[model samples]
Target: MSYHAIVIGSSAGGLHALKTIITGLDASFNIPVMIVQHMSPQSDNFMSRYLNQLSHLQIKEADEKEPIRQKHVYIAPPNFHLLIEEDKTLSLTVDEKVNYARPSIDVLFESAAYAYGKNLIGIVLTGANSDGSAGLKKIQEAGGLAIIQQPQTAEVSIMPQSAFDACPQAIVLSLEEIASFLNRLNNDTQSVAQPTST
Candidate 1:
């Protein structure tokens, strides 16, 4: 299938996991990626800048009412919940925290599922809490693909394990395998989008 977007959620060891995945995508990768990595409300834009420097794709904090564009990575800013509007633009809200996180992974994933339906891919990475499980399940219910980092390979296994339990059909892979699989998806999508000569 030609996935249009990816929504990723993480907590504890999220920075390292995000870095690994973003670095794996080559410059030609076209899928839009949205990420929610739990951070303190006092955090700044440093993480987005750091990840952008490490990735070929442009990485930036998701802005209010900004359109979601392909080949870019958007991260939820601190102290707000990043949501996908029905029109596919972004909406940021200072809604009360869910699962003890302001930028809740569940919030992002659920909204993306509603917006993209089967064209979405939801991935749950290393985390300490169970915040992403229900969201991943929602993605699966919407016929979207679900991927979870292998609990054994995670820095902290609870989050991935919880996702696996919630969505047994999720593809469980190690960090390296996840990267390779995403690259393969990019290649497959490229092949599908190319016009075939008669």
Candidate 2:
């Protein structure tokens, strides 16, 4: 399948997991990556700046109504929930938190599932809470690919474990393996024609 977009969620030990994944993606990686990594409301843009410096893809805090584009990593800003509109653009909301997070991972994944349907990839990485499980299931129900970091390898296993519990068919991989898999998907999309609508 020629996936159009990727949605990732993490918490607690997310910085390292995110960096490992982004570092493995070279400039040739073409899909837009939307991420929600739980952070304190007092947090600044330091995470974006750090990741941008380390990744080949541009990383920035997603802006309201911004058009989602390839070769960029858009991160949910602190104190807001980032969502994908039906038009494939981005919209940020300050609505009540889900899973105790303003930038809730479930919110992003659910919206992306609606926007991209089967052309979406939802990944649940290292995290401490059960926030991403329901959204990963939503992605699966929408026929999108679901990937979870192997619970054994996760710094905090609860999140990945919860996702696996919700969607047993999700591909479970280690951090390094996840990056390799994503790269392979990128290469496949580059060589193959976009899949025709069924």
For model 2, where is the 10-residue window of minimal lDDT? 189-198
With a 3 Å backbone cut-off (N, CA, C), the pairs that clash in candidate 1 are none
In TM-score terms, candidate 1 sits at 0.98
Which residue pairs in model 2 clash with each other? Answer: none
Residues 3-75, candidate 1: write the lDDT tens digits.
8899999999999999998998878899999999999999999999999998889899999999999889999
TM-score list, all predictions = 0.98, 0.96
TM-score of 2: 0.96
Instruction: Write one digit per residue (lDDT tens) for candidate 2, span 1-198.
Output: 888999999998999999999998867999899999999999999999999999889999999999999899999999999999999899999999999988999999999999999999999999889999999999999999999999999999999999999999999999999999999998888777555567
RMSD of every candidate to native, in Å, equals 0.9, 2.9
Each prediction's total of clashing residue pairs, residues at least 3 apart in sequence or on different chains, is 0, 0
